[model samples]
Target: MSHAHDHDPTVPREALIAIAAVLLAVMGLAGAVRLGIVPQSANPELSRAAANVAPAQQRNLRFADREDGAVLVTDADTGETVKVIGFGEGGFARATMRRMAKRRMHEGIGPLPPFTLTRWQNGALSLSDPQTGETAEIHGFGADHSATFAEMLEGARS
Candidate 1:
C-alpha cells in the first residue's frame, strides 16, 4: 500500500524573522538619511582638503562620436576639434561621456553645453557637467584611465 501524504515546502521560521529584521533595518536607515540625521557627502570639487584641493587647470570640452567610430573631443570655447581618440582608445573618457549623454537624452537636454574637466592642485582629476551639476572623480579609476583625461587637459592647454 502506498502511503498518501502532502509535503509542504515553506521557509523556516528563522528565515522569515531574519528577512523582516533586514527590511525594518533598511527602512530605518532610509528614514534617518531622509530626515538628515545622517550627513550628506561633501562635494569633492568644492572641498579644500589636502587631498581634494582647488583646480590648478580647467577646460570646458564637448565630446561626440564620429562616423568613423572614433571619439571627437572638441574645445567648447573655440568650436574646434581638440583631439580625435581612436575607436578603442580613451575608453574611460568615452564611457563617461556616454553616461552623461544618456542622462541628457533622458532629460530632453541637448549637447550644446560643455563639460568641465579640472585637474586639482592635489593631483585629482574631475569631469563636471554644468547642465546637470554632476561631477565624476576621474582619479579614483586608476592612473591609466586618469591619464586619458590628463592628456586631454594638456591638449586643451595647447
Candidate 2:
C-alpha cells in the first residue's frame, strides 16, 4: 500500500467524550449561578439572602442606602450594619470606615464576632448578631467607629 493510503479516517471516541464532559460542567455551573445557588463576589447580594426572614419590624434591615457608590445594608431589628461595602469601585469593596474597624477591633474597639452594627440618627452605633438577630450596645469611636462588620462566622449563627 502507498504511505498516503495508510492514514486512519476515524478519530478516537475518548477525545469526543472528554470534550462533552467539560462543556457540561461549564453549563451546569452557569445555571447554578443564575439560580442564585452559587455565591461569588459578583453576587455579594447573596449575603442578603441570609438577611431575609426578619420579623415584620425587622424587615427593613435589608439594603438601606447607596451613598456615592457605596451601599449601606445590614440587619434592621438589631441595627447591626451588614455590609458597608461599595458597589461602584472595582465592583464592591469594604468601605474605608469598615476597614478601620477590622484594624482597630482591639485598640479600644468594639467586641469581635457576634456583633453587627448600625448607625443611628443620633450618631450612636448599635450592634447585632448576624445569626441570632439580637443586638448589643457599643461606642462609635476609634476602631469601634468603623462601620459594623461581623467579627467572624461564629458571630453569625447561620
TM-score to true structure, per model: 0.72, 0.26
Instruction: Go through the candidates in order and give each one's C-alpha lDDT.
Output: 0.83, 0.46
Candidate 2 Cα RMSD (Å): 15.3
Candidate maximizing TM-score: 1
Summarize candidate 1's per-residue lDDT along 76-143 as a digit string, tens digits: 98888778999888888889889988888888889888999988877888888888877889999999
Per-candidate clashes come to 0, 6
Kindly report which residue stretches of model 2 are placed more than 4 angstroms away from their true locations once superposed. 43-158
* TM-score for predicted model 2 compared with the true structure: 0.26
lDDT of 2: 0.46
Clashing pairs in 2: 61-76, 74-82, 80-117, 81-117, 114-155, 131-157
* Candidate 2 residue lDDT tens string, 1-112: 5697787788789988999999999999998888879855542223334655232111233443365766665554466765555565323124433443444444554533
- Model 2 has a clash total of 6
